[model samples]
Target: MSLPEVRLQIAAVTLAEELSFTRAAERLNITQPGLSKQIAELESRIGFAVFVRDQKRVELTEAGHVFVRGCKDALALLEKAVRTGRATQEEIQPLVTIGHSPYVDPVLVSALLGVHLPLYANLRLRVESMFAQDLVHSVLSAEVDMAIIEEPADSPLLTLVPLVTEPLYVLLSTDHSAAHLASVSFEDFGKVGWMMFPKRANPTLYEKVMEAGKRAGAVPVEVHHYVTPHEVIQLISENFGVAIMFKGIAQQLERNDLVARPLTAAGLQVNIRLVLRADQSSRLVNEFGRAFLKRVIPQGQQAEISGQLLLKL
Candidate 1:
């Protein structure tokens, strides 16, 4: 039997993971109908239905589970082969892909970019910016060697090394009642419109923000979802809303008409971290991580920095 096309294998694997045609297609950058056609062609070539699908949901058939496992292994091996071939070229440096959450502080990104490992002078680093959850997924899928992201849910397959921890800040108009305070309590803005990124951006952080507000006994009169810092800035400056976000984000978008005050609510902090697969075996990638961490936390202060860092979520 002829082997299925590589794209077909990828479509099947992604569909298996997501089980939602809409999402899998989005990940593949293909239309839903196009993805369905690929799966159909793959099944036709293989003489078996890999997925059991209906309008309501999609499920992998008995054989699909085994097939997907093999596909994942094959894809991983193909990736390794490509990397090995590239590294074997006379002048090519080994490439390591690093993903970062868009919300993470620029200093951390700058620090990672500034790392210079003595042992791997020819190492090449590529960085991609994505949402926090997408970074985790990319790491798991081997699309990214490592990622700097906001704290995500605990996963046995991943290790997280905390990089930065700072209290969330409330952004509001200078004329707002709480603008005069050095720090604002959640209660101060409990009755105003609250603006935040949609849950899809970072579900864990989104839920944490909601839970934090509840614990502080402060719920907004209405919550507005925003997709960009500029939008948040616009809304707050126009006195249409207020926001709770990381200090770094607030600082980056600071404006004369706006003011940011540390949010004094407990458990409302943004924790940036370095996340990598627990089973990582690349010496270049591993050493790069060590060198980067050393740059962020100097040798003599490792012990002291450990105490200050939020080591766990």
Candidate 2:
């Protein structure tokens, strides 16, 4: 038999993931019969049944297990190759793709570009706004050179560098009754509805916010799930719901409709981290990472100092 076809191998792996021939066909954007024929041909060439057929569910056979694993590895490599090719031909200069979490302070981007422009004048920066989990996946898959995520990733394949830790705050409408308070405990907002991101988009941050509410005996009265931090602020401004976010998010607001109060309660801090693939050794990524660290660390220190001065007053 000739060498196994790449498309056939890919089809086999996709089928293994979906289990149902119809579902697998949808995922691969092919008809069910076409997908079935590809898988059958692959099995024939490899001389082993790839999937065990059943009336209700399709199960992977032993040969299927090994073939699927290999196919996935091949697909990953192909993805990396395509990304690299695009970077080389389309990018006029060295390109660094940086994935950012929703809470990443927008002002930091200017500071980052300012610092790096002097040294790497021709460097191109591409910013991808995504959730922390997706950012981690982008870095791991070589889709992005690096990322600025909410916290250190727990995965062994990524290396995380601590950048800055910012305090979390409760964002209230300026016209709200409790807005004048110096700081509002979670209990103070117990009866208030909250604007929150969806659990799937930001599981870690959502869980952290909920845990704080639980500790204060304050259940989230209502949650307006949104995809971005800006959307959450908009909902708060519209009086739809209040929100809990890091201090820097306050900078994104233009209207006097919102006021940010420190969440003086303990354990409400968020750490911004720089994450990259463990094996990556890109000069452009390293430069951007350094610029990001230099900008955030100083701002964090200044914020700390200002907070202390307020206490002294």
Count clashing residue pairs in model 2.
0
Judge candidate 2 against the unseen true structure and give its global Cα lDDT, from 0 to 1.
0.69
Candidate 2, residues 245-307, lDDT tens digits: the string is 767776455367788887766676777766777666555565566566656666545444333
Cα lDDT, model 2, residue 135: 73
TM-score per candidate, chains pooled: 0.73, 0.67
Put down candidate 1 lDDT per residue, 1-313, tens digits, no spaces.
5689777898899899899998886665445887899999999999898999999999999999999999999988976775565457313566778998666777888988998867667867889988876677677667788898876656556777767788888888888888889999878884788998777777767888899889888878788887776688777766667987778787777678888889887777778778877766666677777777887865775665444322311
The local distance difference test score of each candidate is: 0.78, 0.69
As a whole number from 0 to 100, the lDDT of residue 16 in candidate 2 is 89
